[model samples]
Target chain A: MRKQHWIEVGVGAFMLFGIVALIFLALRVSGLTLDRNEPSFTLTASFSNIGGLKPRSKVTLAGVVVGRVTDIQLDTKWYEAKVTMSLEQKLEGLLSTDTSASILTAGLLGENYIGLTVGAETDVLEDGDEIRDTQSALVLEDLINKFLINSTKD
Target chain B: MIGLDSLARLGRAGLALMAALGRSGVLFFQAVWGWPSGQGVKLWMRQVHFIGVLSLIIIVVSGLFIGMVLGLQGYSILVGFGAEQALGQMVALSLVRELAPVVAALLFAGRAGSAVTAEIGLMKATEQLSSMEMIGVDPMRRIIAPRLYAGFVAMPLLTAIFAAVGILGGMLVGVDWLGVDEGSYWGTMQATVDFRADVINGMIKSVIFGLVVTWIAVFQGYDLVPTSEGISRATTKTVVYSSLAVLGLDFILTALMFGRI
Candidate 1:
């Protein structure tokens, strides 16, 4: 009976370890924030076409991710996709007032994300300020259509 | 007359299913009704050791192999798109979201689940269950309930083991075998997976499947006709029905939890 109790306890410990590992893997796989004290800064951008851009898409400066697309909606009056990005605190003061945002593909065939290009400006852009110089997603179909028309004219 | 006859048969089938459901519900309540005595607790612990501890090797081996396969496949495809760094994200998401819980349940149904059905079915065939009842003991509370609870408790842990080991296996194939940077593999996975949406949902799936597989195994055994042939038939049904139930429930749960997004 004492042995049985010990065995059960051992099994219980094993199970607890497995559960903890499971939670760790889940957290690691899914990019949920672990720290609450980490501050986030949200900025907005407008584009003619977001293409396949969706919420939670990575926002990158150069090749490294600085934040994520937190929300996306239609700006009914302007008739464009309005994107809101939440950047990590470390990326603060990195964006200038003249900085431009572009929707860029990760590769020739990969996920679409917003790319930040630094501009020559001493003044930094504050939160809630719009990124004025923006490039929309390049639609493949439209580009093909333009190429066909140009070839026909030639 | 033909239509009426078919309707009557359909009604009969539905009624029988309902009665079976009601019986199982009663059995479940009875099993959890009283605080377990020391002997009963001991019996349960032995069963858990068999159902969970004994099956660990198979779960680990299968998990590792499956993860390796995912790593290989994901690398081949991602390399084409020059996004091989996302291999970790792909492997982790696929395993946590679908593979681990569903595969573990299938293996459980095939291995431990089948054994349980056969054991209970044999005990019934030998009149042990009846003899116990004759001595004023409830076979359900005494015999079936402990096994049922053990299965219920063991399944989630088994699934967790499967997922965890599978992720490591992916690392083995992706990082060591394929020359993927270990930092990027782990980093990308951490950046992509969500605790509540992907991981917790997978656990919930395993929990539901645990109840389903055990319920089918115990019910099939309990309702077995008293013969050698009957025991074999019940065992077969236990495996088949449990597998089907796991797959079917997985589809429904996935649709509910992830379909819209």
Candidate 2:
């Protein structure tokens, strides 16, 4: 009986520990943030070349992450890449209408994210508003080709 | 005559393999047909204790060593390129997506799968299973079901623990010993490794491995020739077959989950 009791305790402990570990992995190890209660608003921008930008990529303002790219699609009408992002609602009226969005890489050969540069305007950007000025991602191959051509000419 | 005999032998081998697969499938359904009720819960608990709790020490020790080795290797390689901050991402992704499930399943096969096969094979060899049947208790229900269920429940949990410990071990090596920024190590990991895509997918892989390995173990044990030599052979088969099945199924599962099709 005593041995049986110990066995039960051991199983119980194992189960409990396993559950805790799973929760830890989900909350701490993975990119899942549990406290997403803070409301956010969506914004759209159009670019000529998104390069390798993917959904769930970060959107940064002044080197700090402010939003995430929620969707990326080809704008069939304009022949441009359309990117939709969600930003924290607290900064809703702070971004000017002339603010520019650019695709930037984290480091050389690293993941790509959208970076925002503030512009001089009184009107603030709101949800569903499109940023007029957008910079496309710099294509490394294109840059290399241009560099090689310029060096050869010189 | 020689050629004809060789062809006949190959055909017979193929037929026997198919028959064995069919039998294993049927036995798995039988084991999974019902819920644990009354004394069944106690039997399951005992099996869990035997299989899961006993296997914890090996899982943790191996997970830790493997993670530390990954950290060391990743640091050396990335340091050359000045990308040492990605070490945590590399270690976490590999452990969460591949190593934790595959290696843990392989170990579980060698440890618990073999033990279950041996125990059941010995019972059969000693005529204990027959005695249970003679007493009007179905040995399949009484002996096999609980063990199979215990394996199903234990494996994913064990695998989760393995991955969690492995990540911590990587942090120890990458951050403490290697002088990588502690903030960036964990921050990059948390930013990159998706819970749904990597972690949950790994859990799913372990669950499938557990089912297949346990099914193979119990089926091999129950269908043995009930001789001492047969018992030994079946035990060996359990480990060998389980490892192969885990590896093969991992490929299919990976292709299905991450293939974007």
Candidate 3:
């Protein structure tokens, strides 16, 4: 019985260690970084609907994550979700005065993401500037319900 | 007159079946909820020792091989499309969403479920459960509850083990074996695969599967006759029912989550 107990303990310890190690390795390999190299700037995007949008969501420009959503606040003035994004230093120069931010899907049924369309204007938008012309995501369920409702009328 | 009597008997039978099902459902929930009490904790730990710790090596080894195979297969397919970077996302999503939970549940049912059925069957044969009842003890709250709770807790932990090991296996093939850049593999996964809902869905499925497997095993065991043949039949039923329930529950969960018909 003593021998059996020892064996059990050994096995349990090994499994616990192995699982923890694997999770640590996965997190490390996934490039989950906290250190910032360049001066970070914040910009706000207001959307009528930020469906399932949460802080720490990636802010993508041309499908690449340039920053992350830092804060999401309800704008009482406009009754919209004001999403504040922290842009990485390297991508700061691309945020022009005419740049447009839109809430879009990564793929069909995928999570909602912020997509930045680089503007042609030469002047870069300063920090804290709002990207006012933002498009909200077209929720698929709502669209389907609308289509079904509309089609029944005819 | 005879036809009317027969109709009444059929209606009574239907009502009985409905009552049995309703009682089982309520009992299952109560067992699950009452599992965190002091005695329940000890039972849960024992189950963790048996199910999670005992099955770790097998789960990890299988998970690693599955991950490696997925990486090799995904790499080949993506290379054909000239999109090798997507391999990480493919492996991560498949492992987390499907393979890990199903495989872990199947293994748990076979290893732990069978043992539970046999143990309870032996107790029933020896009149141990009857003795408990005579002594004013509730077997459902005491014996069955702990086993069910243990299973519920163990399944998710085991699933996590499977997912973690599978990812490592993919990383080994993508980085060390195939000479692909480690950064890109991890980068693609972080960018595409890791979602909050994926983890939640996996855990929820695992917990439900665990409860079903344990409940079926205990129910069969408690209903077993005293003969050796009855024990054998109980064991067989336990495994068969557990596996079917796991698969059936997985289908329901997947449909509900993805909202596909």
Candidate 4:
């Protein structure tokens, strides 16, 4: 009976240790912060071309991550990509209505993310408001083609 | 005449293999027909202690060493490309997505699976299982079901532990010894390794491996011929078949989950 009791304790401890390990894997290794419930608001941007931008890609302000791209879809009527972003609530009333959004690539051959540049207008954009100014992803192929054509003509 | 005799032997072997597969499938269903009741829970715990707790040391030790080796090798290779920062991503992804579950399952097969087979096979060889049958107690219910349940629960946890420990080991080597930037090591890993795709898929693999290993172990034990040589053969078969099944199923599962088709 005593041995059985000890075995039960060991089993219980082993299971508890396993759960701890799973939580570590989820939070630390996999980087699942589970912070989606934090206060944030949605905003949208339209781009002619998003390139390799994906949902969950970081939205950065001056190289600091301020939000994440929550959804990306094509606006069939406008014939452009509609991107929805969730920003920190602390940024509310800070970003002006005329702020510009551009898809930017990280490093060379790295992932593409959204970069935000502040605007000077006093009126700030609110949740679900779409930014008007946008720059499409710079396709390297297009740049190479133009460079090759200009050099050949010279 | 010789060709005919060889053909007849082949047919018999094929029939035996089919019969064994069918019996094992039925045995799995019978063993897992329902959830454990009040008294069955204790037996389940005991099995967990026997199988899971006993196997922890091997899993952790091997995980640490394997992770350190990955870190060392990854750094040497990535340094040439000036991509040492990606070491964390490489280690975590490989461990979480593939190595942790598959290696842990193989070890579990060798250690716990073989042990379960030998114990049950010995019981059969000694007529203990038959004695329980004569006494109106179902050995399958009391003995086999609890072990199978414990195995199903233990495997995923063990795999998780293995991944967690392996990551730590990699960090120890990559960050502490190798002088890779700690922030980039962890940050890039976090950015790249998706929780749903990598971690959850690995967990799914572990669960499937658990089912295969335990099912093979219990079936091999129960179906063995009641003799010393039979028990030895059953134990060997448990390890061999469980390893093969885990590896083959891993490939199929990986293709289904990550093939993006």
Which candidate tops DockQ? 2
Top model number, lDDT: 4
Please give, for residues B35-152, the per-residue lDDT of candidate 4 as tens digits: 5678889999999999999999999999999999999999999999899999999999999999999999999999999999999999999999999999998888888999999999
**Model 1 Cα lDDT, one tens digit per residue, A1-154:** 7878787886787678677767667555565666845788989999999999989899998888888899999999999999999988766777888899999986676679999998999998888878999999988899999999999998
Q: Candidate 3 on B142-215: residue-level lDDT in tens? A: 77777777676677777877887888899899778887677778777876554445655776787788778888
- Return the TM-score for each candidate structure: 0.85, 0.96, 0.70, 0.95
DockQ of each: 0.45, 0.86, 0.17, 0.84
Docking class of 3: incorrect
lDDT of 1 by residue, B166-218 (tens): 89999999999999999999888887677878888998999899888988888
Evaluate model 4: give its TM-score: 0.95
* Per-residue C-alpha lDDT of model 2 across residues B134-189, encoded as one tens digit per residue: 99998877889999999999999999999999999998899999999998998889
Q: Show where candidate 3 strays beyond 4 Å.
A: A1-65, A68-154, B1-23, B26-30, B33-40, B135-137
Candidate 3 displacement at residue B168 in angstroms: 1.6
The digit string of per-residue lDDT tens for model 4 on A1-154 reads 9999999999989999999999998898778978658999999999999999999999999999999999999999989999999999999889999999999999877899999999999999988899999999988998899999999998
Better of 1 and 3 by DockQ: 1
Backbone clashes counted, model 4? 0
TM-score of chain B of 2: 0.98
lDDT of prediction 2: 0.94
Interface RMSD of each: 2.1, 0.8, 3.9, 0.6
iRMS of candidate 4, one decimal?
Answer: 0.6
